[model samples]
Target: MTGFEGKTVVLTGAAGGIGRDLARAYAGRGAAVLLTDLSGEAGEALARELNEAGGSASFFPADLAQPEAAGLIMEAAVRTFGRIDILINNAGFGIWKPPLELSVDEWDAVLNVNLRGTFLCSREAAKVMKRQAQGGAIVNIASTRAAQSEPNSEAYAASKGGIVAITHALALSLGADRIRVNAISPGWIDNGKFGELRPEDHAQHPAGRVGRTADIARACFYLTDPDNDFVTGINLTVDGGMTRKMIYEE
Candidate 1:
């Protein structure tokens, strides 16, 4: 938080949910935030709100599934803020269907947005970070489904698992350049209605509650913090202990 002053953070899928909270958290901590998402209306509105409230912010509308999207985003961020210090790959969608029922188009869509997009963005940012004296951080937003999953979630699981693998791979490749890369696997984060929850929902986790956007946002900050330079290539699970619990069906 203290070190983020004047830093520039590029956050994808920042129009809503965890990405939106991340944009706010980084900006609130004194970072200039570049918010990108396919939803231009909402993304632009959030950028305006942040700027009006005295945070340096801008919105770049993009569909990360495209091959050129990532490069364009990084270029715009540099043009606006001069440099990129942190990159958060949070643009993704899930598809749940029986393996036999899933279509190739659906599978390709998820993979392109979730995995390929992350890779493209990280590659572009790393190139820029390598040229600078001060290196940077990249945090990929994976899901707990990568390690544990329910039926009919093959596409989502594969994409997230790829994220974990790519995180370590990038870390090893970029370490010499001082660019740290890591991944966060979140479980049961309620980005929907927060007030409409039952006691059983909170009781299901050993942490005694479901995850919030702030939980992931704080985790992002922790991984990207200059003080935690030694932490990289690790998949930090912010799942409230649910992934480690064993539950037997009644």
Candidate 2:
């Protein structure tokens, strides 16, 4: 139960579908977490809910698209928790657009948040984790589109593809410092009622429903455990076998 006790995690996009789940899951497991998101109110409310439930969390609102936002959130987490042992690059943007239909600005925006944000957060986390006598872990949330993509997914697919590359590169770069890095690509996340969808949205996943926050959360917990010293530079696909299914089921 205390696998993560006393550990501090900095999670970006903490107000979004998967992000919110991650914040609660980590806090529930006794991790002190800093939740960063573009929505100040939502981030704060989520943190408040966790704290009220006996978990530890604080909101640090920041937009990953901004150049300074990633560093700012890292600094805030360290200031609030004394140190950060986990970094979840969970904030990202997905704009489905064909090559001709997609705008340059839109492409840039998506890449900046999805790709650049991951880079920025990893860089900052690497710096702090290096100082710790004990090392840390980093989990980057990508999409299943990186493997077998769909139409109008140029920007998003590219961003996620870049994520796998970065995971390998950073794993090699940070292994010397005892920091491990990995990525998870979630497919058809059936995040129920995110914004306005009904519970039926959960049926959208091939696993008889959409992906659960626990699905990804479990992976994150496994990869970050103190005993998990040998696992690194891996890209796990927790998409309910959707990506591997060749036939469309009824």
- What CA root-mean-square deviation does each model show from the true structure? 0.9, 2.7
What is the per-residue lDDT of model 1 for residues 1-250, given as tens digits with 9 covering 90 to 100? Answer: 5559979999999999999889989998999999999955899999999999899999999998899999999999999999999999999999999999999999999999999999999999998889878899999999999999899999999999999999999999999999999999999999977679898999999999999999998999999998899999999999999999999999
lDDT by residue (6-44, candidate 2, tens digit) is 999999888978888988889889999999989668888
Candidate 2 lDDT score at position 229: 84
| Model 2 quality (TM-score) | 0.92
lDDT value for candidate 2?
0.88
For each candidate, the alpha-carbon lDDT, in order, equals: 0.94, 0.88
C-alpha lDDT (0 to 100) for residue 194 of candidate 1: 68
Worst 10 residues of 2 by lDDT: 193-202
